[model samples]
Target: MYNLPGLTIRTISVSETNNNVYILTSKTSGAQVLIDAADDAPAILSLLADAQEDTDATTHVSAIITTHSHWDHVRALGEVKEVTKAPTAAGEDEIEAITVPTDIALGHGEVRSFEDIELEVIQLRGHTLGSIALLYRDPRGPAHLFSGDSLFPGGVGNTEDDPDRFLSLITDVTERIFDQLPDSTVVHPGHGNGTTLGAERPHLAQWKARGW
Candidate 1:
């Protein structure tokens, strides 16, 4: 229950893969941001419509933020962008064929502010060339993390794609994200159920011992 000032976080399951598409909104301003668009066109469109209906008429998607450029993470980006007419943003190396917001390429320890909440983009490359995790701290509730594919419940992201990259990602997670946030901080992964940093910390040694 990490409640940022005016921010509302909603997660939707998309595709057969169960990719999680997160929608972040400002309850005060009615501005919205989307994280990942991996579902089918119809499903995403329905979600957008539902979100719009729930908020004010001016409530429109401000941007589409992709945590990574993998096909599963961006399968419906083009369609969603066209429908919402919002700018799309991704890491420099991970952006796909879509138009990227080069001017605002988020990097390690970089903070991007919305209407009321501030998001710190952390470089967690390993899940992909440009994978990133977003950390949000709000006065109302606990801190929140959008950990993309770089982290999950029992362990870190998959390293099968690139063993070296996975190792680096794991290290980044340990020293950067895990070390910084409070143990109770909530982690919203790119897929599956949400978890807490505290629940995952005790196993860090086991994960590191296993190696990438």
Candidate 2:
């Protein structure tokens, strides 16, 4: 129940892998944003239904945003889209081959306005070629980050497929995300529990020491 100024962000856990699917709604306009449609159609559908119920009004799911296009992150996207009839948005590079209606092509430092809230997209390419994270300053809660598979608690995203690319992703996390946001900012990662920028900073030295 993180209360952002004009937005309410709810993190819903799905799948055995514990992937997090976020439901963001504008408190002022009731516009909905779904982040990461993980591999569970029933769970996602149920969550949307609950959101509509709780809001007591028909909430339009404006977009289904995928942090990346990996199978684990996007398995339920088509079903969710079919059910909600929301446009799916992703980084151009992330969903290269997938033919989905991309309402927005996110890039580094791009700000997307959804009703009353503004979401800043940060490119984080270590976990995948098109991995991206979102940063926003909510009026109710502290600044928030939706860090897809780019980051985690006490660890970083796995880059086993490409060492050089992994190193670059780690660097982006350190400089772009950690350095850009305040210590009080809350990080809601794609997988695992939430953490703060302050809590994750102390481990930066340790991760850097590992030499990617």
Find the 10 residues in a row with the least total lDDT in model 1.
95-104
Identify the runs in model 1 with alpha carbons over 4 angstroms from their true place.
1-5, 52-57, 96-104
Q: What TM-score, over all chains together, does every model reach?
A: 0.89, 0.92
lDDT (Cα, tens digit) per residue for candidate 1, span 48-113: 656554556457777788888777888888888878778777766665433433334667787886
The numbered model that scores best in TM-score is 2
Q: lDDT at 182 for candidate 1?
A: 88
lDDT of 2 by residue, 47-114 (tens): 76666644545678878888988788888988889988888888767768445556677777889876
Model 1 error, position 189 (Å)? 0.6
> Poorest 10 consecutive residues of model 2 by lDDT?
49-58
